[model samples]
Target: MLDLVKLSGQIPGLTQHLHQESKASQERLRRALQVFGRLQQEPQVWQSRHVDWGSHLSFTCASPAEPLENSRPKIEPLKGRHTVVATDGSQIVPNHHEIAYCSLINVGRVVLHYGTQQWPLLDSLPVLLYPSVELQQNSGLDAEEVLALRRAQAEVEELAQLALSVPRRRTTLALVDGSLIPWGLEPLSGQEQRLWLNPLLAALERLRAARIPLVGYISVSRSSETVNYLRLGLCPFLSCECYRYCNSDQAPPCQTFAPLPDRVFWGSLLQPGERSPIWRSGAKVLNPFGEHHIHCCYLNVSEGSVGEAEIARLEFPAWVAADEELLKRALAGVLSQVQKGFGYPVALAEAHHLAVVRGGDRQRFFALIEQELIRAGLRNVAVSPKEAQKRGGIA
Candidate 1:
């Protein structure tokens, strides 16, 4: 009967589909409830390998660089600067006097552009607000985080509108702070994860179709592919060990594949799978407490300040590490360079919300980007924060 009713909406009831839908709710809801119960035995992991303590990329200023006193490789401004959009997002948590209210915070917004970085001013930095309206909010996140995300999105929307309102600069790149795809998209069959990744996946397909050349910066992502391999061992259903099912959704009537595109799945070998090494130029190995070793991706995100004597690059959380001090420093470094470079740096933090580091995996380091501009196929797929050590972008 329900199928009959749905079929009616698809056919003759086209104009009154709403009426048909309302009439069929009870029956459909009943079936959906039964399906949910049947599915309860499924393993539940509140965590998809991606969940972990968020870290920051930090830096301390050295000294300001001398103004370009004379002629020194002054390439003409990026010709017809199309758009080099680099986005980043920071979640503001609610920690107060009495209780650090257990509230999650999120700020998912993207920044817009229309100018060269050499002279980034209010007029140059534009924002893109409403275009993201259809995205599903991760209300699953802490309530405060959801609110913060909405607030931040609203702010950027206003900024984009305002930027469009006035005279503009030659905008080109759109720097999204996070991943090329949204958080929960891949591993599409996972219960909780899908709720997040679905919309993000849609947005990514749209952008990719547009050929926007989007860069997904996963400063501190645990390769979901690797994490799953480590945790569940094989395809949740088949449990095969032959490196198959690389792209199947979690709870599924799954299929198998081999050697999926690097863009489609993160390198599983470096950590568990064959990880990509696009950031080799900026990699650095760290003995954080001077003994226990860790490899990380260090990008000279910005020349916070420079002198012939010293160069300061803001570093941010690139991996899930054990030390709090290290994480704090990294986060501080990335944010510090804003005043010296351009006001848009913080704006750079808004565009990316999900942290999927696929397609030439990279950490957020503007300097690293500058370094890899020449290498063949410089971009990597699912770069690990550990790769920071491999990157030559050492402090």
Candidate 2:
């Protein structure tokens, strides 16, 4: 359906614009790198810098878990028998055009045992949700968002259950596809939080009690957590009042440095297999997380040349970040999986494969629903005209 000939004419101009943008970006990166180097050299200045964090509006940054100038730790080659348990989820949100007001969640679980003779465990758990009181709860989130929240909850709960199933003596690391913090529950009311947030927190608590470290892996993260923190270090004023002082048409002094992502600087600093220091996440959603506070570190999973370094953000709970041994095991397991999977975690990839629901599967799902509805003695059961037309298609 795309017109290649029409798009081809604009390619030259687009390419030129991209090249110019890239050049400018590279220059800005250089400036950011310089600022980072200076901060790294003057550890005292970075340590002593004062900024009234409360003065800012909706500000979030990375809280340093260790000294800013701490050495980049290289991931040790995973030794001895270990297990990496990963889970990912896929969902089908309720369609208004369909008769049933229902949603489905399928979570794929993978337990890969390395340096052992035991076979890997792979499975998927699918749950069907009908119209229920939980669904009707006023959570501010729409049907799609509610589905996502439920899916995330399902993934972590599955991960916890699987991790607990592993022998307590064995070293096990739990990884989910994204953030451990339940950001989706932030907008929910107290009742909704009890519905969603409490279950997630309980799952996290189970992992904590069992001493299994839970990690969230994000590839090529665009998060500016650390960059925002460093911006505070660069503030020239003793006190900042953005609205009163710096609110103007011209860019502020601190704005001179290009707002590059935290990954780019970390990728350049960390060698292949090295990880940056742990930084606490300042996301407001984490305020209610209590002992299960999320922290992050950048892992350079690239096995190629320095220029090809792949930076991945690994987020874990406060307990894992606090314990050196647990953190090491978590990092080692992730790096081993990435190397085996070719720059991506093998367990997660397999889990995703097992979790994905294809278009044919979706069509079949609705068909099953319709069959059940019909068997229930409902008359004139049919899809909306929009849905029927979509299925009919045009010649």
Candidate 3:
């Protein structure tokens, strides 16, 4: 069915293109490293500088000083009585060829109680979109916006469910697989804030009221918040005027620094069982949260004689970050979980397993929709002709 010979012919050029880009990136990295080292010594000069760089810069670096060492920090072992829960979500976008006029969001959740040896609990929730007349009429919204809303709703619902299900007496730690900050909300308008921000904030508040220690774990992150801080420090002029004179071209002060990711710097500094110092995220979008703003740190979760150590970015709310005991417990719980999954948290892996919607599932779902429509006495409850031809394999 496929031509392997023709596909194989494109490999050489693609390889060459990648090689050239990689070579250029390496050079840029080298230059960035030099600037990073220089800023490390003069931390005070840049520490107090304030810049309103607008929506493009989502986070600020509160602590530019080198990350603290945790060589022998108290790492509490999991009591085995505690509860670990994780949540993940998947979605199906509306397709024009399908008979249905709606989309779907499915959230998968897993709860694991260690030491008891009991089977882990699993659940999947499905939600129908555009169920109301008002919602269906708002067709001006793009696919990205619809998908984002679905994802946000799924996350909030999962968190709310966890709060209600887990008992207050039990020590519970909740893990979300990605950033706590909702994506694409940095430049939020008044309307968007009311529609999106309020719901997420309410969910977060509910979780906090329940006293559950929640953490967002990002594996292999490429965020450069720290690196950008260093860049700001390198600029001699004030934040407002610096951009006018220092453009990021092939020459000048901007070119001296490489576009190194924050992980690269932390990976070199952190040893196994250690975590970098906590840094407050200066994401202006989080300003509305007041005491519940986000903070982050880098953690090295590797064990044994692994060739390359595993590093992850751990993000938590300000309340959790401020408390040393809570932070340590979260780190220990995460480390224990990671050990079981071989560098990943087991709870998250199970949640993702339950959330994924396969191709066969999609086909069956559409078939069921068509059947229901026909049963409702609707005429022509069939897929578009073009879609039918494709499905029938006419070539």
Candidate 4:
């Protein structure tokens, strides 16, 4: 359907623009690296200092939980028997074009035991919501978005349940695919937000009660939390009043490293199997987390070459970060998993494989729904004209 002839003419310009941007980005990274070196020299000074920004001025950064000089600490992966559990979820959103207004969530749970004869546990549980309440909420979110929130909650809850089942005698690590922070609840207030958030928090609390270290592994993370904190080191002002001043067209001194991500900076510093200093997340959504406040560190999982290491963000709860031994063991366990899985965590990969809902599966699901409607004596059962046309396609 696309005009290749017309698009071809624009490709050269697009390529040129991308090349120019790449050069500019490399230059910015060079300047940012210099500033990073200066800040690393005396991390204690930066750690002692704190910046007070207004509530309206939101930025992604974290408070240092360890000395800056501890940037890249390598620990040998834990030996002996330990268990790693991971959960991932897939969802089928209610489509208005279809005959039924319902949603489905399938959560895959994986538990792998190392240095033991015990067989790994792998299971997938699917939940169906009929007469979907999410559709009636009118919460300004589409069906897919609503289902996504539900799926996220399900994934964590399942992980928590699995964590509780694991024997406390074995050192166990709980992992989810991405950041543990519950996002997308920001726009909603009061009970609406709590309705979706409470269950997630409760699940996290279960993990805490079980004393199992929970980790959220993020691959190829582009988060700039550490970079944003480093920006303070480059500030020229005696006191930062971002809302009041620094509004002029002239760029602020901190903008020298404006576009750098924490991963790029950390990848340059950390060797394979090494992790950066832990930092507590400054996200507002975490205010409700209380004891579960998220803390993060970057881990270099790959040993390919300089500048080619695969950087991943590892997030955990306050309890895990507070205990030095637990933190090391957790990181070590995760690194061991990463190495065994070939750069990705094997438990998470297996969970994803079990949870993933393919296109053919979707078609089969809808077909089953339609068949049930017919069996229930719904003679007028039909999909929307748009959906019908889509299935038919243009010849």
Candidate 5:
């Protein structure tokens, strides 16, 4: 509707301007296509080795002066045995139809699951933090965005408490699924680091104080900064490298979501130890700024394939009131690019079918979806499209 309005009447000159701009865009894309074509034919072998995830961030804050060498408290897991549990959470943002935010916390085993309906067994974690109605209000933002962020932060804090409180037979590593400091999150700061990172540093300290270990686990593709790195280096206009061509049951790697070279722990707190300092991505020599030396653990994605596609469904929401055509077009470009990178055919774009199945009935819809699956070369198409849609659940 808005496109029609813009093209027809409202902005008057926008439609005329878009034509020229689109032509220019097409020209630029054509040149890039030629380059990509050459690169594709270069016979690069695909390797199954893990991508060096980029966004795994962790920090231990400065511990208070020891109370005359206070005795360490014994922290034990929920069950008798020492176990490592991973917790993940998903967030659905407003502009984006839904945000699948997940955090993996490693602790003593208690049947940990952090996936959506599609991810079975990995369901219902005691520490899963889904967006509650109370935290969903996105208005003119500012206050509301901060409030929602706080609620989300509080949710993680509660998990931290749970994770820390868990019994540590040895050092129980708490694997947080994403960035520790929270990406694109913070107050307009004129305040000190303590205002923001002090409490968090303290919380992590509680675990350290108890001699438990916490490790952050993150999928490479999720970090916006990490994505930006790939974008700037390889495909800036593209949202992802491989999944540009189709909307399939595939997900891009998520750990690539990291900040720029040195921004990982720019103003955060730190806990010093043998490995008390954090190393920035580009640091040729150790910098004394970030406390990486203290929090000896870090993880990241591969430098080359950081932007590659995956074989899982990732949650990227559509706009508030976009029509199917416009929605398809927007996703089409992305799906097209993703498809091209992954070596998949264009027919697999979006959620379309192999052959046009022309009914709105459940049987027809799922049948069409399954037929596409078979054509798309999915080995296991047992889960009907309808089932997948059900599993695809909301966004």
Candidate 6:
């Protein structure tokens, strides 16, 4: 049902554009490498000093040691009977023309028992939001905003379940598939933040109170937090004001580091089962967390050649970062899952598998909804013509 003829004509032009951009990026990376080498020779005292770049720019940088030069720490083995749990969410956005004005969120969670005879458990929980004045109005939220709220709620609920299920004596590592920071709150109004972020923060507090180690795993991350540190060292201007207000026309010296992603730098450095040094996250979105600001580190999960290894970013709260033993155990649990998955975390993979809703599943769900509407005396229920046409396909 695809237009192969049309796609074939477009493929060559797309490929050519990508090739050109790749060449340009390579040249930029070369210049960045030159600056990085020079910055590496600076004294630790100079590198550690904080630079004020105004309120908008983050002053955070990598640890003083050359990230690449540091040797990988040995992977710690799972000591005793431990449990690892991960949660992922999927959603069905509200359809305006449907008989019922509602949306659905399904959260899938997996609890894996390591070094024990207990069987692994996998399950899902679904939440349905019905039409109401408060639910609909919510300060005139858009569709994306509504979805974001549901996602945050789903994650919070699943985490609460994990917190309640795990025993006090067991060493538990609770994982979320992505950043713990509520990034969706960045563009919204203050009221929206209170509505969404509060619940997630409350859930985090519960996990912390339970003394469970929680981690956010980001696979194939393109973050440049480390690269930003290298850029700070390359700033030639003596006055913080000059660098703070510098624009493209003024062209600060660190512009050469533009396209370098953090993964590229760490992938070259870390070996299998190794993790980079933890650094405090400077994401402005983290301001809401206050005393529990997020910290991040990179882990090389691949078993292949160093150049080809997959690097993942792991994020945790300040509490976990402060406790060395808890951090080590969490990292060990992640590495164990990654080894079983061959590159990714098996618990996360299983959670996603349980959470995803396919096209066939959607069709059956709607068909059942239609039947229910008919049985309730609202006969001749049907989808919008556009939706019908999409399902029927083109001849």
Where is model 1 more than 4 Å wrong at Cα?
A: 1-80, 91-171, 179-195, 220-395
Q: For model 5, give the 10-residue run with minimal summed lDDT.
A: 267-276
- Residue 279's lDDT within candidate 6 is 74
Can you rank all candidates by TM-score, best first?
2, 4, 6, 3, 5, 1
Candidate 5 segments whose C-alpha is farther than 4 A from its true place: 1-81, 86-144, 185-187, 192-194, 222-278, 281-395
Candidate 1 achieves a global lDDT of 0.31
Score residue 68 of candidate 2 by CA lDDT.
69
lDDT of 1 by residue, 233-334 (tens): 122533333234343345322122221222223221122111122211111122111221222222223223221111111222122123333333332323
> What C-alpha lDDT, on a 0 to 100 scale, does residue 151 get in candidate 6?
76
What TM-score would every model get versus the actual structure? 0.28, 0.93, 0.87, 0.92, 0.31, 0.88
Clashing pairs in 4: none
> Stretches of candidate 2 above 4 Å error?
41-51, 54-57, 189-195, 241-252
> Using alpha carbons, what is the TM-score of model 1?
0.28
| Predictions in order: lDDT | 0.31, 0.82, 0.71, 0.82, 0.31, 0.74
lDDT of 3 by residue, 267-362 (tens): 666777777777777666676877678888877888743226777888888778877667777888888889889889998888888887889878
What value does the lDDT take at residue 82 in candidate 6?
87
Q: Look at candidate 3 and give me any clashing residue pairs.
A: 32-258, 60-282
Residues 242-329, candidate 5: write the lDDT tens digits: 3453334642332232222221221111111101112122211112223321221212111123223232111111110122332222
What would the per-residue lDDT of candidate 2 be over residues 254-373, giving only the tens digit for each residue?
Answer: 665556788887877788888888888878777678888999999889888666899999999999999888888899988988888988999999999999998998889988988998
1-395 in candidate 4: lDDT tens per residue? 79999999999999999999878877877887787677779665455445454232336568788877744556687789999999999988787788777778999999998889999999899888776565546787766878888889989988988878878999899989988877677677756777787898888888877788899999988788887777666656666555555776677767786677888888777888788888898877777788889999998888676488999999999999998877887899888888889989999999999999899988888789889989999887888999999989999
